[model samples]
Target: MSLYTFAKNLVAVILFPVFRIKIIGKENIPKEGPVIICSNHTSNFDPPVVGITSPRDIYFMAKGELFEKRFLGKLLLKIHAFPVKRGMKDRNALRRGLEILEEGYTLGLFPEGTRSKTGELGRPLAGAGFFALRSKATIVPCAIIGPYQPGKRLKVVYGKPMDMEKLRNSKASAQEAADAIMEEIKFLKENHSP
Candidate 1:
């Protein structure tokens, strides 16, 4: 198996038992073509949870600090994680994201830009919306619920692919697309039961 697959499977083996992950709406993931998996950030565990549950491989833009450690950086890179300097507009990272989509790969993004301290949805960064508009990729909003308590169920709900055509034609701002995506995620989180 590729390192990405091995790592994803390894993570699933380690976390699934402890977290009892429950996935809903996985079918919403497109079988082929470019896709953008947008979700809220709560814990560091969110990425792995979403990655393992997703049907396709996911490329993520992690914080640049994560790559500061040599070993961890290489390992993360091997497993499809790239570094991005957070809190500012990093053009390289944005370009890389668009490239991934152009190549028809899945790009995973936490629209909030960072983890929420109170486990509440935060305003989405314009990056997510930019990717959707620029690449015109299928955007899927995901909501992850429940804490990382051992033996406690962690639920991940994937919403339907958003229709961006209207927004694209309306000459909507990236922030507007980001807001709409967040609204869908909020809906899933509030309505989907654990």
Candidate 2:
């Protein structure tokens, strides 16, 4: 099995029961082709949960701090994650993300740029929208609902792909496209039921 698959399964075995993760609307994910998964960030577990539930392998851009350790950095790289210097524009990270999509792979992003401490959706950075427009990849907006208490339910809802062509045709700014994606995530979070 691939490192990504092995790591994902291991994480699922360890964390899924603890969190009681419930995934909804997974059928919305396309079986193939380039795709961008954008979602709100709250807890540290958000990325792993999304990765575990997603049917496709997702390449993620994680903060540079996580890779400060030599061993962990190597492991993360082996499992399809790269580090981005947060609070500054990192051209290399952005270029790598586009390359992943150009290769018809899935890329995951949290466009808020950082986690929201209050559990509320925040404004998104333009990177998500930029990726969609530049790579012509399908954008899937996801909402992760969680208090993250052990044994409490944590849910991930995947919305349908955003209309990228419409956004492109209308000449939407990168920030505008990101805003549209977040609005969908907010809708999913508010309307999702147990």
Candidate 3:
């Protein structure tokens, strides 16, 4: 394993139980190959919460500002994260995501684009769907449910992968596909509310 993987795993082992994280449906993840993990954004902690609970290394797209700090940016890179512009189409980020998939790695995306301040599910952005369509990768819908309080236990639910082939061939637009994915996440969130 890469040093980054080891470091992340160590941190997860150390903190997840302390945070009372409860992960479900880990077996739903494919054992290998490129997979897209599309999840809801409830808090700033959601990324690490999902990432640490996952069985494999998951690369995520952060905003460009996160990477502007040299030290923190270097650390993020080591942890397999790259940056995308917040309000604009970031071609570079798109390319990096495709490259990660092409390299047979898992990629995590919050289709809602940003964290939900009120902890309500937001309309999903089309980036995740577009990536799935372009890369022909399987999309695993995930939901993280809980308040971000230190002592509260969090729940993570993983849904079955969406049928990308059907999505690709159907009349559904990219945004439609993204919405469908978000709907699945919403269902899981409500059902598995912590």
Please, what is the TM-score per model? 0.97, 0.96, 0.93
For residues 68-94, write the lDDT of model 3, one tens digit per residue. 999999988988889999899899999
Models sorted by TM-score, best on top:
1, 2, 3
**lDDT on C-alpha atoms for all candidate structures:** 0.94, 0.91, 0.86
**Clashing residue pairs in candidate 2, if any?**
none
lDDT of candidate 1 at residue 42, scale 0 to 100: 94
lDDT of candidate 2 at residue 145, scale 0 to 100? 88
Q: Predict model 2's lDDT versus the native.
A: 0.91
- Clashing residue pairs in candidate 1 are none
- Tens-digit per-residue lDDT, 1-194, candidate 2: 98989999999998889989989989998999999999889988888999999999999998899899999999999899999998888999999998999999999999899899999888999988889788878889999987899999988999988887888999999999888888988889899945
lDDT of 1 by residue, 91-135 (tens): 999999999999999999999999999998998899898998899
- By summed lDDT, which 10 consecutive residues of candidate 2 come out lowest? 185-194
* Location of the lowest summed lDDT over 10 successive residues in candidate 3: 145-154
What local lDDT score does residue 60 receive in model 3, on the 0 to 100 scale? 91
